[model samples]
Target chain A: MEIVIVSLLNGLVYGMLLFMLASGLTLIFSMMGVLNFAHASVWMLGAYFAYEVSRFIGFLPALIIAPLLCAAVGAAIEVWGLRRVHHNGHVAELLFTFGLVFIIQRSVQMIWGMLPMPYRVPAALDFPLFTIYGANFPAYRGFMLFISALMLLAIWLMLKKTRIGLIIQGALTHPNMVSSLGHNVPLVFTTVFAGGCGLAGLAGVIGGNYLVTESSMADAMGPIVFVVVVFGGLGSLGGCFIASILMGMIQTFAVVIDASIGDVLKPIGIALSSETLLGEILTVPMARIGPLLPYLLMVFILLFRPRGLMGTRDT
Target chain B: MSTTLRAGAMPAPRSSLVGPIFRIFLIFALCMALPWLFYNYTTGRHSGFMLTMFSQMGMMAIFALSYNMLMGQAGLLSFGHAVFFGLGGYFCIHLLTAAGGGSLPVPLEILPLIAGLCSMLVAIVFGYMATRQRATAFAMITMGIGELVATAAVMFHAFFGGEGGVSSDRMIDRSLFGLTYSQGVQVYYLIVAWSFISILAMLYLTTTPLGRMANACRDNYERAQFMGYDPKFVRFIQFALSGLFAGIAGGLSAITYEIVTFDSVSGALSANALLMVFIGGTNAFGGPILGAVLITLMQSGVSLISNSWLVYVGVLFIGMVTFAPAGLAGLIAMHSPLQQAGRLKPLIVPYIRIVVPGLVTLIGFVGVVELLSFKTIGAAQGKKLVLFGNPIDATTAQPWLIVTGMFLLGGLWLWREGRWFHTLWEAMMADLKPKKGAAQ
Candidate 1:
């Protein structure tokens, strides 16, 4: 019962964080019709920025400032850089963002050097919030959950209630009609891009402290983010949310277990020696296969359900 | 926004001169002479540096050119082309190992071809599934498939051999021509020969009916369908054929290195192919060759000085896409009018103006890169970081100031001269065009 409860809470926290990162990427991908390969780089920058800010100021101020700076960077890149390549078509746009990935990664390395930043949680939030069956649930993780929840609510309110939000929604579903309605489509794009980067930054600020804030964090997170985006389907925030949570749970749960195909086959009277390929496959633990699950799910989704679970349109 | 021009409509037929028979002879000549040229003129048999580089170039040329067949002609963007190349290498190594054990009857020289064919077989399955979609969906599918395969390559030990990867003895079985294929130069020549034959075959493929239809489908699928061409079939065939060439490249790699690893099939290799194809200019048949050679040279040369070379490549790539959408081939094609009118000589002054600033910028950039990389990777390796026999500390203010100054000066000069160069280029081109009435 304790193991189950712990996994469930961890999964929720992990899922929420994935949602924060994937939501921004989904919005940008849906609106622009270009998968921003540099999205994870933006997340990495947020963490680096937060770390730098925290060194000079308090953690609270750093969190707010870092995300805003990321938004500004995103706006500048969209307005000045991506806009120029938009007319060249999709491949060119993808290539442009792909180029930005290298630049941003190297620039981060140059600025921060190659060492991992020690961005610790604030003392106030460092202690355990509670104990579940004698297992301590750290207060920092609880704070992360709260912050992500707040973000989710804020995004929901903005999307449903605000005028700009409504415009963004209309543009997302029907871009041609939004333009015909005299809306500044370019302005909408800039705003959406900024918002997406800001969200990615928020995830970075929170996750950087939660996880290891290393130079290779971006590369590690990049493929998973891409898997989420592709698995959730392009242009579907709801699908993105679902896919993020599912992936988070899959990864979290897969790590905790030690069962293998051999164990599953044991009851069926199928025994294998260590001499064969099948034996090797059967004996590998679930912990060892944790990294393979996301990719396997992604391939299965692309092959069987091209549109994804909650996706409204095909990518 | 500029109006979309429907440029690609129909594919051109085969070239009249240098038919398949002549091309085959040319390939043979080029291959046989390559090893002799490398051995006699340059460093002979000392770890086979020239031969190794040549073999690498040949393989990559095939890989990049094959990738272009999908991107340029078929209008399909694949992020997983390394899958075929890596698979080809793995199979070739496996075959070589089997032949060494006397389980297989194939000669070492023909093993690469077998690998290429095996890659084509895998391509048929992957291509059939992948060609079902178009555009973004197609790209996503390819990425997913690539990731799946890559993960499996690391996961399974039977075929992929896990992280340490698979290695085999290249000196396997009897030689086809009654000579032991044991030397670096011999293997290099074999790869070159196979590369030439593969490229010629690829070139021939583009002139066939299937290739023409691929162009037709790429330009307008609806129109192609109206003309009784199946775009799906066209894409499938092209994808398979491209895989075949990529596999040949892979086989050459396997034969040369005698090993294949997860890195061989990684996303980086796929990205490299994309970079090469785009840089070379996708439209021309020989464009990928130029891209492959330039990229390989840069990889060998520039990477020795800087770890941040990828950043420069990325920036150049983005700039290329935004400014010259058609690529280096397209840029060269743009100058054809001036060359045809014999007014190319007049533009030399303007070209030098631009080039001088460009050279300054490049020097500044490379210097900064070398300095930074020397501080990091070099320092970690415990190598003395020196410039002209003077040890320089990266933390020092002097080096920083010098780099900043060079960057500023070079950038300002280039910005000022680039516009003047552009205007002069236009004027020269206008002057070069023949009089309309006289031409008629």
Candidate 2:
């Protein structure tokens, strides 16, 4: 029971972190119809930037500055790289970003070396915030949840209550209509692209410390984020949110489960040996197969529901 | 008019057939002569490195061409195409092991064919699920499938052999050619023959009805549907055929390397296939062949010199995606119309002007990358930065400034020269257009 509670809390924290990245990716994907393969790379850059800034100035300012730096980089990439390839088509744009992943990763390794940075939680948030059954939930996780909730509220308010948000919403569905109405659609695109990157950067700033700040971090996190976006369905942030938490729960809980298919089937008088492939598969513990569960879920979901759980548009 | 039309139609098939046949023969001859060309008579043997590299190029050519069947011909961008390749290699290695143990009586020559058929079966199963969606969805599903298989490969040790991977002896002692399979040259010849056949088969596929319909569906699925063709079925068949060829390449690799690892089916290899196809030019039939050869050369050659070879490849890929979407083949194709017009001589001066700055800029960029990498990776490895036979200190500021200045200045000059060249090209093309119209 205590393990379940701790896992739930841990899962929530991880889910919120995933949502922070997924929200940006979904927004950019919905607006441009080009999935930024380098979105995770940008997140990695943000963590590095924040580590650099916090090394000198401090963490609070780094939080604000790191995301801004990521936004600037995103803007530059849009104006120079993506915009030029835009004429060629979406596949070209995707390939361009995909190529950027290699460059960004190599560049990061060049600058930071091939080791994990020691980016730790602030001293103020280092202590336990509360006790979940017997497990002590850290204050840093609370901080993460607090910031994520604030971001969620801010994004909702911006999208619902602001003129720029209205323009963005209009452009999402009707770009030509928005363009002819005298709103600078290209500038809006740059803004959204930068804004999405900024969100990713913010996620990096918080999650980097919670996780490990390393060069391969992007590679590790990239596919899972894609899984969340696809599982939630395209063009639906609400779905993305639900999918993120569900994935977080699945990953978090899968690690704790020690039972195998053999254990479940043993009650029905089915004895299995590990010699055969099917037997080996059935006998393997769920914890050992934890890393593979998300991809399996994604494939099953894709095969069954191509539009995802709550997709508003065709994938 | 009727006689002239019939004459034109009659010559079309023969004339078209003759060129490809000639090209195929030429390619076969070149491939056959390559080992001899690199032969070290002093040692009384072929250069092992050269033989291995050439053999790798042939296998990769088949792999890249197979990938192009999906990307270029069928317009399906698969991120998990390596699954079939890897699986095929795994099966081939296992079969080779069986043959060695006398459990299977099959000769090594026909192993690749059996591997290809196995891959085709897997493709039919996977393709049925994958071909249901088009465009981005297809790409995503393929990616998911790729990740799943790669993860399972590591977990399911029975088939994949875990981290150490599966290995087998190539000398199964069952060759129809009556030659012992112990020599590297013999294996090289086997690869060359298989590559030649595979290339010809893939080329022939392009001229078939299904291939044309695949292109039709790629360009406009609705239009193909209106023409009473199921785009799904076309994609499925094309996907399966592509898998067959990829499997053949995988089998060749298994035989050559005598091992099959999870890396063969990993995302990196899949990305490598994409890089090869895109770099070679997807629009041309022979683009993948060019790409496979060039990339294999770079992998074997450039990687030896630079720690940051991937950076160069990434930059080159991005540059192609942005500026040269038609790729090396497309760039070469651009010059043909001018050559035919008898007006190619005038552009030589402008071309030289562009090339000079381009080379300078490339040198500058490479210098910057090398210096930075040397400062980090090379410094850790305790390697000195050597340029033009001079060991220079990467810690110093002087080399940095010079390279940066060169990059900026050369870039400016290249941009100006590029504009001039573009105007000149446009003028020449415009001039040729009118003359061609008049002639017609």
Candidate 3:
């Protein structure tokens, strides 16, 4: 019971982190049909920037500045790089960003060096917030929950009440109609792209300190972000949120459980040896399978529903 | 759409003369003579690098060409092509290890075929599911399938060997003519022969009804449907055949490296295939060959010189996408008429001026990148800082100034030369006369 509750809390934090990344990716993907491969890289940059800023100025200010920096870079990439490639085709745009991933990753290594940075939880939120059944909940996690909830509320209010948000929703569903309405579709694209990147940067700011701030964090988190976006469906924040939480839960729960096929088959007298392949597979702990869960879900979702969980179109 | 531009015209005598058979022979002759040419002229005693590079290029050439079949001919861009390639490689390694353990009698030369067939079998299963939709849906499904297989590759130890991967010896006891195949050059020759055969086979496939149908489907699926063909079925077969070719390449990789790992099916490799195929030019059958060779050469060579090679590649890929979407082949092909009309001589000076500045810019770019990367990654690791074979401090004003100066000067020179180059090219294209009634 204790384990389950702890896992739930951990999963929620993870899910919120995923949501922060995926929401931006989803918005950009929805508004502009180019899947930004460098979105995760930007997130990584945010983390590294936050680490640096936090070292000099403190954590709260670092969080604000890092995401702003990310937004500026994102807007520049949109105006200078992607806009030029857009005329060619979607594949070209995708490839252009694909190239950006390598550049950003290498650039991060160049700036931050190979080793993980010494990013720590802020002193104010360093202690335990509470304990449930002897499993202590860290204040940093509470902070994360607060931030994510705040972001969710802000995104919701903006989308429902703001002109840019309404325009984005319209563009998401009817791109042609939006263009025909004489709105500068390109300007909207740049704004959404920059905003999405800002969100990713914000996610990175929290995630980097929560997990170790490292050069490889982008690469490690990249596939999971893709999984979340794809599983949730492009252009659907609601779906993105749901998929993020589900993936988060699946990953967290998978690690704590130790059951395998052999465990299930124990009563049926299926004795196994380490030398045999099947036996080896059945003997491996579920904890090690944690890395495989998100990918597995992605494959399952893609094979069964290419458009994603709640995708309106076949993206 | 421009009346001033002489495109959609008769392709000219140069295209006719360079015909399929002639090109094929030329490629084969070059493949054969390359090793000896390098052994004689270039750096001596490092023939190992040459053969290794040669084999790697041949394998990647097949991979890229197969990718072009789908993206270029069939117009379906797949993001997860490494699935088939990796699958083929895994199976090939399994077969090689199995043979090493004495369960088969087939020679090493025939092993790639078995790998191809296995890849085809897997492709058939996956392609059926993937081909149900087109465009974005197809891409997503393939991505999903790729992730699934990659995950499985790390999970299943029997075939995939988990994370450690599978390894085997090429020197199995069985031989057709008692060739042990121990030497790298021998392996190179084997790769060349297989590459030639596979390329020719792929080219031949393109000329067939199935290939034509695939193109037709790509151009306009609605029109293809009206013509009594199922577009999905055409795509399925094309996907499967492409898988067969890609698998052959993977088989060669397995045989050459004597090992297979999850990296074989990694997203990086998949992206590499896309880059090679697209950069080479997807408009022509031979485009991927050019792309594969150029890209592989850059990857292996440039990586040694600069850590920011990925940045260079990113810049090049973006440039190609924006300015030359038709690719390097298309750019080359656009010049055929000028040569045929004997009007190429006037453009030589402009070409050289452009090329020289471009090379300078590239060199400067490489230098700056190397300097920065070396300062960051290399300096931290305590690696030597050698410039012109002498140690030079990176923090010194001289090196920094030199790199900075080169970047600024080279970039300015290249920009100035680019205007002249474009003017010359546009003038040449405008001067050509288009023949009446040719397909656009």
Candidate 4:
């Protein structure tokens, strides 16, 4: 029970981080119909930027400044890079971002070398928040949860209550109509793209230290974020939120299960050895196959529910 | 928005002097002679580096062309195409092991074909699932499958051999030919022969009805469906066939390197295929061949000179995506009508003008990249920043200022020259348009 509670909290923290990245990607995909392959790279850039800023000025200022920088970078890419490639088609746009992945990764390496940064949780958030049985939940984890929830509320209110939110929502379904109504669709696009990237940046600000701030951080988090976006369903933030938590739970809980197919099958008179491939697969603990579960879930979801859990349109 | 022009619709230049068959043979001859061309008199043997590079080019050509079957011909963008390639190599290595142990009666030469068949089977199963969804969904599904297999490859120690990967000896003692396949040059020849066969086969496939239908589906999915063809089936078949060729390439790689690692099946390799096909030109049949050769050259040659070669590739790719969607082949194809109309002479001066500025800009850009890389990666590796036998201090601001000046000024010059060249080319093309209309 203690393990379950700790795992649940950990899962929630991870899920929220995943949501922070996936939300931006989902927004970009829904708006421009181009999957920004460099979304994680941008997140990585945010982390690096925050690391640099926090090294001198401190973390609080980094929380504000790094995201703004990411937003500026996003706006520039949308204007100079993506806007130019827009004429080629969505595939070209996607490829352009894909190319950016390589450039960003190499550029990061050139700037920072191949070592992981020493970005850490703030000293103020260094203490234990609470004790669940024997496991002490770190104050940093609570801070992460608090920030993510605040972000979630802010995004929801911005999309639901504000006048710009209404206009953005209007632009999503009827871009031509929105354009005709004297709204700058292109500007809206830039804003949305920048805003999404800012969200990713914010996630990186906290998640970098939460995880590891390495050169391979983007590569590690990239595909899993895509999986979340896909599994949650494109164009649906609610679905994305649900999928993120589900994926987080699965990832967290699977690592602690300690059981395998062999355990399940033993009651049915099936004894599996660890020699052959099939036998090994059956005998391997769930913890061992923890990394594989999300991909398996994604594939299965895609196979059965191509529209995803709550997708409005077929992908 | 600028009107998009499809490269396939461009007129083929009349080649009265050189027939297609002769061109193929000439290219084959060049490839066959490459090893000898780089031979060292002192060593009394062919250059191993040249042989390996050529062999890699051959295999990559097959891989890129196969990828083009989906991206170019069928308009299906795959992110997991390397899964087939990696699986094929893995199976081939296992087969080679069996052949080496004398249990498998199959000769080493036929191992690629067997590997290809194995890959085709895997593709059929995977493609059945993938082809169910078109466009973005298809891409996502393939990516998922790729991640799954790659993860599984690392997990399952049976087939993938874990991190150490699977290795095998090429000299299985079972051969159709009487030669012992122990030398690098011998493997190069084997690769060349297979590449020749595969390239011809792929080119032949482009003319077939299925290939034509694939093109039709890519251009107009609704119209193809109206023609009573199941677009799904066509995609599945194309996917499987491409996998077969990819597998063949993978098998050749296994033969060349004597090992297949998880890298072969990784997303990076799949991205390499995409890079090759896109950089080569998706619309032309010969585009991927050119792409494969150029990228392999860059991978082997440029990477040796600079640690940031991938950054150059990425920039080039982005440039291609932005300004030249038709790619190098498409750019070449654009000049065909001008050459045919005997109007190419006028553009020579403009071409030279652009080339000069282009080269200057390239040098400047390369200098900046090298300097930056040298400051970080090079400094860490304890390597001095050297340019043309001159050791430069990276800590100083002079080099940075010089390179940045060169980059900025050269870029401005290139941009100005490019506009002039574009206008001149457009005028020439406009002049030929009416004549072609009259001829039609």
Best by DockQ: 4
Over the full model, what C-alpha lDDT does candidate 4 score relative to the true structure?
0.90
Native-referenced TM-scores of chain A, all candidate models: 0.98, 0.97, 0.97, 0.98
Per-residue CA lDDT of model 2 for A173-218, tens digit only, reads 6778999999998898899999999999999999999999999999
The regions of model 1 sitting more than 4 angstroms off are: A269-283, B1-12, B16-47, B374-377, B386-393, B427-440
**Lowest lDDT 10-residue stretch of candidate 3 chain A:** A272-281
- Write one digit per residue (lDDT tens) for candidate 3, span A82-181: 9987887788888788878878888887777888899889999999999999878999999999999999999999999999889999999898899999
Give candidate 4's error at residue B179 in angstroms.
2.1
lDDT (Cα) of model 1: 0.83
TM-scores for all candidates? 0.93, 0.97, 0.93, 0.97
What is candidate 2's CA lDDT for residue B46? Answer: 91
Over 4 Å off in model 3, which ranges?
A265-284, B1-18, B40-46, B387-391, B433-440
In model 3, the clashing pairs are none
Reference A-B contact fraction recovered by candidate 1: 0.52
**Alpha-carbon lDDT, every model:** 0.83, 0.90, 0.85, 0.90
DockQ of 1: 0.55
Tell me the docking grade of candidate 3. Answer: medium
Off by over 4 Å in 2: B1-15
Residue A231 displacement in candidate 2 (angstroms): 1.3
Q: What share of the true interface contacts does each candidate keep?
A: 0.52, 0.64, 0.57, 0.82
